[model samples]
Target: MLTYNLSNIGSDSLYEHLYKCIKKDIVLRKIKPGERLPSKRTFAKNLGISVITVENAYSLLMSEGFIYSLPKKGFYVADLNDVQPTKQVHQETVVLTSGHTHYLADFSSNQTESEIFPFTTWIKTMKEVLKDNQKELMINSPCGGILELRKNIATFLKEFRDMDVKPEQIIIGAGTEYLYSLIIQLLGNDIKYGLENPGYPKTAQIYKSMNVHFEYVNMDSYGIDPQELERKDIDVIHISPSHQFPTGIVMPISRRYELLGWANKVKNHYIIEDDYDSELRLGGKPLPTLQSIDVSDKVIYMNTFTKTLSSTIRMSYMVLPESLANEYYKRLSFYSCTVSNFEQYTLSKFIENGHFERHINRLRNYYQKKQEIILNAFQSSVLKNKVEIYNESAGVHFLMKIKSKKEEKEIINNAYSKGIKLNPLSKYYSNSIENNNIYVMNYSSLNSNKIEEIVEKLKQCI
Candidate 1:
């Protein structure tokens, strides 16, 4: 008889207690590989627990790879060292099912609402580009990008952003992620990268995955603190000064100059300015890029068409310093990061014809209207006293700071159950133990009706 003490189990649920006992034995290697477990009925009877409890524990053990079952035989301790663990392919299936169900509102992504997309105009432009640039599409262009697109980008920057960039300085790639990845590889290793705390998680995840040393610089209402940055010995700083993600706080000109001064003081250091959504600034005059302020060739500016145009475009470009541009071309000579020639040629013509400007103006006006609706709805809500909105004047999303953190999950769950999805503030933090009561709600995807409904539902939840 295997002498096992049952009196020590303290869990309220018999199955949970039994599961832990077997899992502990398996982990400690006391239950040798391929050792058969007691039959479910026998084990349950011996322990004075229901048979279903033992079966449930065994099923869980098998699912988690702690044990295995043989045909018409019994469950045994698994040889974990040699076990081919099952991939979690089913995890996404459940999420997909839940996502497809028609919801009253969804404020998750920073994308323009489905109804706002200029589908007809885009299709017309795409067809024209394909027809006129068919010959260019047949062959591969330079890795840096087609000359026409580069020239158009330069002109666009000059007219709109007051950026004095040339075609030679522009390098086109699929998206911002790809462009940033190239920078990481080109810059080599052993350099410290700095990111904004409570900023875009993707930026942090990519750097960490590359095994790069990085620090999170704390952010304030004015954006990332330059004084705090002086304390850390960082080689590069990545910032989204135009419209900071999640918070939507724009960096003031004084701080921008200060940051530039910091980079100038440190020799060979770089700053990556991610102008992800600057084109959508509704009220004030659009700010000049950090690259434009670079007197010392310290800032590398990158922007994407993903936000302004459409996500499917897969087009983004960077304006590199003359020194860096030369090095990049020489290093990436064999590797091609150029987009499709047809698409580039089409986009060039689109901008040259002034459609791009008109498109941006239309979107600016549209977003302004949506922003107004959101502001009005929130102001009149019952939860107005309990929650205060931040970053409402700009960007696609706004942050709602609650009075307490206790109801954070409750509110999220209630909203989710009502077909409204929200991202909790804690989700954005690397350190979750910190007390944060903010919730990020994107208005870009919500229509006026959806926005009103969402606000009313949120009021009830609070």
Candidate 2:
């Protein structure tokens, strides 16, 4: 008979507790291989629980190859020829979904504040889209996403970014990570690729995972050094030109032209312009995209709603040159669009009705004020004399050069121990080029009400 103290299940459900207890016994061979499990009713009576709970536990065990069932013969433990004991892992990792401890001042996260989302307006737009697009919602989106959404995006780009692109030239996917995979397949893996050193880590991680041949090209003060690309004989170069990550250096017009000229010289040379947070630029008009200036069809432009909209949106898109767009359809049209029809229709209506634009305007104002509050807090902090802020105008994050003699790793660890998560600039680099004593401070998600406490925590970290 199977029995467990049901009263001590704690937070777990009865079935779940029984499942774990039985699984543990089976792995330990206390419930031997080929041993018959008690009938659901009998086990339920033994443990003083419902028959459904016992049945649920048995079902889970059978599903996991821990046991087997016959029509009338009942459940029996499977032969345990190769099951191994579980290795020790962090308790929090097993129990908590986020896997990291909450921090008082999390300068490592770039997540947008949840309060900034216009849920009322968004839900209203979704309802409107549902009411109007019933027939369209039933149909699957095309490989390049729905025509309506693409059209709205194209119009938005022209009006805001000054880039004239046709709907056919855009490709929508679940996220930038998915789009990067498509880019790799569209552009042959045989070519050499260049990524900016000390750039976004995920970009490098994606290229490496896909078995792509890529090199880290060092950046000068302006942005990616075109002269280095020439020296490296790179084929495809990925850069965040409008506002570079961590450093927040916006590419000068001269450097943008130089990169375009470099791409023009070679037959298949191309540049990938990742204009991630251009919409949230705090000062002046956003910079014109490199694609808008490229006459030779050498730039593939990419952006994501994860910055402007909520991170949970999982929507991103790219603008391909006309030639590449044709090539993409020819080579990869069989794959269906990754986003759902409902989301596409809703977002299309949201953009077409000006809700998205209004939301972005509101968000820009909110973030600008948040930035001001945090900067003011830092200015008044005890560590104000020990830190220098840089590139505070553009993205949600910027660099803070700390005047400390401690090694970067030691400083970061000290901060983490004090509930302040800090990410050093040196950690982003792949090569030996050192960027010491600087940390990237992402403040978009910081709680403005806790600014004083957060500043005190930062003071302690320093």
Candidate 3:
């Protein structure tokens, strides 16, 4: 039987805390493999917790594959022999009771402006989908997602990204995270991957969670330095050539060709191009995707509508090369599409009827106005001389380099003390480098009335 002291239940929910404690024990190998856990009622009686609490904890553990149950028998521990054991047992104890409402203005987030979401347009389209395609709602999405949606996406990519990909090469998934895992499975496990150093840390976290061996490729003025790729013996590389996160540097055409040459010369090497926020480019014409110029078919293109559309929509897709697409069906055909038939059909109609394109155009104009408002607010403020904005013409966020006498942590702390949330640029780097005072000032959440106030408060902190 398992044992734990339940007398001092702090702020966390009783069941969740209990679940974490048991999960920690399981990971630390305190309980032996295949050990039968005590019955929920017995455990509840022993620990002075509700039986329902115990049941919920057990259910969560079972869901996460930490334990298994037999119909006639009790629950038993799962084998963690393959799981790379960690020394630290106790996880972060402080769980926030309140949500993100604690912050006054959270500029750290890159979420789309919810105020501009096309709710009425989407609702009308969804109603139409329900009225017309009643059969689709009851069935599962196609193995590669609804064929109509895939066809519309292919057409959109041809016009929006200038990529000539067939519908068969595209696979729709729930989100970027899901697609990342599928890619890992599609490619063999014996692979060494590389992610950009000052890139989205979620990518690295996902790779680490899956026990993937990945390295951080350092960046330069343009993008991921080609020399860094040559230096490391890597099998796969994930990058955002069009509008890199936080940095907003579009890889020039020359650097892109250099990458293609590198992939072509090397055998069994591929590039994962994450063009996540490409549709939101403000002023200039949309840049050509690297997948467009790849005659050798070594680039795996990925994009997500979650950023452009509502975050809750959770629709992302990937475009694999012809060979990889064939290999996927040969091996991964058993997997059903992560998205549902109803939502997929609605999205198909939305794209087919020219609504998605119009929505994107409206967002472009909306974000451009917001961008100008925030930049002008900063320039007019007293801190204007101290803050240098970079790559403001492109994405929803711009890099704000602060010329301050204080260190990065000190500046961030001061800002937080004033109820301001700051995303320091140094937090993104996994490698040891020079201390650069940069902050990612996101304007998507910027309120025109509060822009001056936020800038003023930041001025006081700096």
Candidate 4:
């Protein structure tokens, strides 16, 4: 009789312990293909467990394709060659836990609160647009964008961001990622690029996939160091000046000028300024974009509706410098397709009719109140000393530096056990850095009640 020890497993049921042991043996290829498994009666007798427990383990293994049973003979190790590994199919599905209608707290992503979305007004406008512009809505828009929408965007930027742009200069695409990809293609592969260190990983991943040569520029509270640019013979710099991701630090005016001056010194170089989440200023007026200051036509401004409106919209526009706009159009005309005509028409009307501004103003006020609620919750909680909040005056998300002596993995694992999800700061850094204690928390998605719940749970977890 082959005897298996069950004493090693603590607190786990007999079936679970057996399942884990068998699963590991199969994965490590200890059990060769066609190897016969012990009969449930024999296995249970040898292990001193009930037959039902062994049967359950075998049933699970068979369901997962780790083992197979012949009609009369018995169960055996599955043929490794015949059994293909399961693959996760990617789909456009947002996974939220149901039944639990409200979460005590969640800090997953900065999404508009439920009450902030103008669903009624949006539906009314959408219906009106569909009724009035039926013909135009069915047809494909121009590659650049609908002329009216482009004009609205141009005007909005000029008034709000102080950008000097024409309708022809703007190109609308799916989102910031798509626009970045298009920009990469327009610039071609020969140029060297500079990306911020401890910056958005997606930017680096995208550029790296295109086989572009890029260097990392270390960032400080003031923003990306201009002195770092002197070390690199780079042709383009990708920057997020308004609100830096993960860190949430705003790039100061002095560094903005210095960066522009550096770009001027580097002949044939350009700056890709991603002005993401610049409109949600909590206290001061919105800063003028780098594109607004670019007299040499060296800055390519990119903005998206993902932060302001719903991320599902996937609407983004880029303001190309006059020097590259014509060439970009010629290149994009051949390959790029415009967004939906109906959406373009609706958005154009939204801006023209002043609904966009009204929506923004409402969201700003809603988020400001939400920010205060979060701040208050943290201040009153036991986690006050354990977490140091950064850049709380602006943006939808803020950084919290974990002061506990425990490892980051330990903290994350503990949080996970309590059904809380957290984004670790270490994931943002590509190069070595000193501050590994930071974590990005988004309060925009939760209500005051939810925020309190999350903070309370966090206190207990810590």
Residue-wise lDDT of candidate 2 within 382-455, one digit each (tens)? 77898999887887888899887776655664465455778788878886545478989988878899988877
What does candidate 3 score on TM? 0.80
Show where candidate 2 strays beyond 4 Å: 1-101, 432-435
| Count of clashing residue pairs in every prediction | 0, 0, 0, 0
Q: What is the C-alpha lDDT of each candidate?
A: 0.78, 0.86, 0.84, 0.79
The predicted structure with the larger lDDT, 3 or 4, is: 3
TM-score, every prediction: 0.78, 0.80, 0.80, 0.80
- Give lDDT tens digits, candidate 3, residues 241-329: 98887787889899999998888988788999999888989978867888999999899999999878877789999999999999999
Candidate 1 residues 1-462, lDDT tens each? 232454444523445567788888988998899899998878866765446567767877877778988888988888878967677475411112333424466666665555766777767888988888788778788888988889999999988888998898898998888888888877765888899887789988888888888998888778877777778887898999998887778898988998898889977688999998888888788677888878999899999988888766789999988888888888875778558777788788888888888888888898888888888777777766778887766667778887755556656554654556667767766666454667787767676867777778777666
Better of 1 and 4 by lDDT: 4
Off by over 4 Å in 1: 1-102, 404-406, 433-435
| Quality of model 4 by C-alpha lDDT | 0.79
Q: After superposition, how far is residue 22 of candidate 1 from its true place, in Å?
A: 22
- Candidate with maximal lDDT: 2
Candidate 4 local lDDT, 370-416, one digit each (tens): 88888888888888888888887777888888888776655654454
Q: Model 3 misses residue 334 by how many Å?
A: 0.9
Local error of candidate 1 at residue 115 (angstroms): 2.7
